[model samples]
Target: MTVTDSATTALSQGWCALSLLHGRIETHIERALQGGHDLSVREYSLLDVLSRQHSGVGGHLRMQQVAESVVLSQSATTRLVSRLEDRGLLNRYICDTDRRGIYTDVSEAGLALLAAARPTNDAALREALDEAARDPKLAPLVAAVENTHHDGRA
Candidate 1:
């Protein structure tokens, strides 16, 4: 094969590995969260994100921002919020300054559930990474994930 072909093949392989690693981690976390907290990964993620909100300026997130932070479409985020609100785990309100703007916050019950589930989520993530690292094709990706920081820095 030509050098260009080799480079393309390598890139394709890396992409596949990344996708696989993501899927594995998500599935593992999903199972753990569901089994322990009756929450899907997406639900847990939404609760966690909303739990961080505060009353200070720039501390709150709009619906669109919440959707973006949770990596969901606006409609999907709305549905998720509705589900949680129905469960008394979330509360939604219109922005005082912007009638069109809506904000969401985790309720007291949501905070309790999230606190209980945080360890399960973290454990599942670590377990998934450890398992993935055993595979030669995925070890690098696993290492890269582990070495990454919450601020998006290495």
Candidate 2:
């Protein structure tokens, strides 16, 4: 095959593999949610991000930062945060330095919920990891995908 044809073939296969992986992860997250977590995958991701930021940054993250991490539009993030705030899972505060900026932090109840869900989340992750480990060739591909940052960082 010509170089161009070979490249196209490789690209197609890579896309297929990525789609399959995405579907599998979504399935795992769905299973966890249905098993009594009471939180969707996106909500869990938001909580996780807030928890990490709070622990590292001494308790607050800008709306933009959280939106980027969760792959949501700014408006969508605002709505999601509002829902979480209404549910007592998070607290939003106006930034004194920048009136236009807002910050979000996990609430105590949110932390408790996250703690309760940790075991299930860990179990799902472990299963995925185990499957990857068994497939020597797939392990590196998975790692590379995980480590990839799509935020314009080189």
Candidate 3:
């Protein structure tokens, strides 16, 4: 293969490995969360994110921000929020100052569920990463993931 072609092939392979790693991890976590807490990965993620909000300035997240954090479209995030709300795991309120803005927070039940599910998620993630690390094609990606900081500074 030509130099350019070789480079493209390598990049594509790297992308595929990353995608596979993410899929496996998510699936593992999904099973664990669902079986243990009746929560999907997305639902657990949404609850976890909303649980971190505070009343201070810049503490509340907007719908778009929540969607971005959960890696879902805004509409999907809203629907997820609604589901949780129906389950008594979340509460949505219209912003007092800005009638156009809406805010969501985890209810007491959601916090309790999140607390219980956190360990399940973490263990599933660790198991998935360990399994992925055993695969030659995914080892490097797994290492990269494990070494990365939350701020993206490795």
Candidate 4:
């Protein structure tokens, strides 16, 4: 179905608002996580994904898998992994069967950091949503975001 020009305009405006809201929320969470736990949002996300994917073969995942899981480019993910490894937050190993494959697992320290950062990030998100929802026009979008999150968690 074809959308009218006005509908298209509204859609574009909605997208812009959503993008701005996303940036604000991300910034809030990034600052909170970094200030409270010395972890960047992306780093925390990588650690969280590693913890979730930990299983078998020293409880690690291939580098490619981690890259895909974190939605980061392979090079970016590699750099993050290196940083984590240097910080003793995670460890890397060569896959036994695949000579070319490298695997990574969260260290005891990484898990601990992730545990500490989770609440801080969550609280930041909640606060951001609350602030945004104060605007009547944004309440519906906030609800939609909350519902989407709630549904994802379920």
lDDT of 2 by residue, 54-143 (tens): 434445677777889899997898899889899999987777767997778889999999988878887886577557646654666677
Error of 3 at 6 (Å): 0.8
Q: Which lDDT values do the candidates have, in the order given?
A: 0.94, 0.79, 0.94, 0.86
Indicate the worst ten consecutive residues by lDDT in candidate 3: 145-154
Error of 4 at 154 (Å): 7.5
Sort order, TM-score high to low = 3, 1, 4, 2
Name the candidate, 1 or 3, with the larger TM-score value: 3
Model 1: runs farther than 4 Å from truth? 150-154
Q: Model 3: per-residue lDDT, tens digit, 1-154?
A: 8999999999999889888899999999999999999999999999999999999999999999999999999999999999999999999999988999989889889999999999999999999999999999999888887778545885
In candidate 4, what are the lDDT values of residues 1-154, reduced to their tens digit? 4569889989988888788788778899999999999998899889998888645554567777788888899999999999999999998877778788777888999998899899999999999889988877677889998898889963
Alpha-carbon runs more than 4 Å astray in model 4: 1-3, 56-60, 152-154
Candidate 1 TM-score over all chains jointly: 0.94
Residue pairs with backbone atoms closer than 3 Å in model 3 (clashes): none
Write one digit per residue (lDDT tens) for candidate 1, span 50-102.
Answer: 99999999888988899999999999999999999999999989889889988
In angstroms, the error of model 2 at 122 is 1.5
lDDT of 4: 0.86
Q: Which of the two, 2 or 4, has more lDDT?
A: 4
Q: Name the runs in model 2 displaced over 4 angstroms.
A: 55-59, 129-154
Candidate 3 — which residues are off by over 4 angstroms? 149-154
